[model samples]
Target: MNILHFFFGVCGNATALFLFLAPTVTFKRILKNKSTQQFSGIPYVMTLLNCLLSCWYGLPFVSPNNILVATINGTGAAIETVYVLMFLMFAPRREKVKIGGLFVFVLAVFSAVVLISLLALHGHPRKLFCGFAATIFSIIMYGSPLSIMRMVIKTKSVEYMPFLLSLFVFLCGTSWFIYGLIGRDPFVAVPNGFGCGLGALQLILYFIYYDKNKKTTDDNAIEMGPEKNPHQAQDQAQAQVKRSDKGSQNGRV
Candidate 1:
């Protein structure tokens, strides 16, 4: 049983690492294009906060030092920092100002939490406070993808939502839930339970709307076929007349 718990913990950490890094491809595109395009920096900001809180929660001051939790989330915080910097660099001035303001606000709030936890609280109280804070943030982070769900419904397309990311999130959640259950840690389990459910819903919506978007695209192409064919034929006729006229002039010459 102990071994099983350790295995699940490791798996959970691995999947969570993948989840944190999943946006690399999107950011890579943004970097290559030298624009933030349609991507928003808010989610990455929230994710960074989530990682910070999680890292704090797993620290010796807040709880037992779970190296797995600390390491992955610590790395997550670093990666998210890079992503947010890239976003700030490439995003328009208006968006950059907004994200910069939001980043400042997040930093202020996180600093307050750390100060409170370290200076005022200690031992079990500190653990409970930090644990609850982490759990709440994790739940919020899991639901961050709700915006994508709304877009999926509104556009009838899953193009904005990456399926593999959802899959990894679900897997990560499941692994953590099991690990928490076996280890008797509600703070870790509860949020992940919600995460699993939300991830599953996203996957279902993807499958449902994926085919609809494809069909709609195909129908639009078909509807435009006749409209394009006539224009194409007219252009060809004009080109043929020009060629014949040129040939006649050359013969006369």
Candidate 2:
């Protein structure tokens, strides 16, 4: 085996580990609230779809001697499916609709892109075209967290974001980039450049919000129920306090 291959493979494996751990924050939120209202299922659903696509794309190269990509992406699809199902179980009706719409959109667009590319190109050209399209989608998918990043900056609190997950995303991106470079997979490597950039920004924002000396602030506080009733505000405040306490505890450890 080539030394460079070994090195890149190692890096890829390490980064994959990071990606796996990136959902801890989401899981913790579920555990803390016994619900999934604040979290969105679109990302995980998209991730599963992406994994499935990767597995499908790798089928031709899935010999016993070269099944790494197939195996990893196939496993990814399975894991993400479980996560999405769990999310659906606890999500609100509106959120569920959002996820469902996103799922359909992803399926439609992904299918169309694959079909068009397959029909329009062949050999190395097909690979490049597919890779380019995949990179564009991956960049958009990974950049989906920017809104949350902005929320963090606005609130000066990492309440909705978590540090470890951000770190994992960054590491995952770096790993995939190395893996792509080593395997000569431009499609895989190119999108990860954007993923790494977004992930790093997320990490930076986390530190800015959650650092030891940084004070917590809530800028966009909104009322949850009827505003006319003074008692409603009190009740909402009490419930929010409970949720915030649990969320903070869950986040800290």
User: What overall lDDT goes with each candidate model?
Assistant: 0.75, 0.62
Task: For model 1, give the 10-residue run with minimal summed lDDT.
Answer: 219-228
TM-scores of all candidate predictions against the true structure? 0.80, 0.68
RMSD per candidate (Å) reads 12.5, 9.1
The CA lDDT at 25 in model 1 is: 68
lDDT of 2 by residue, 213-233 (tens): 543323221111111123343
Error of 1 at 15 (Å): 1.1
Winner by TM-score: 1
lDDT for 201 (candidate 1):
87
Clashes of each: 0, 0
Question: TM-score for model 2?
Answer: 0.68
TM-score of candidate 1 against the unseen true structure = 0.80
* Residue lDDT tens for model 1, 125-218: 9989888988988998888777656656765555545667767878988998888788788888899899988879877986787654243222
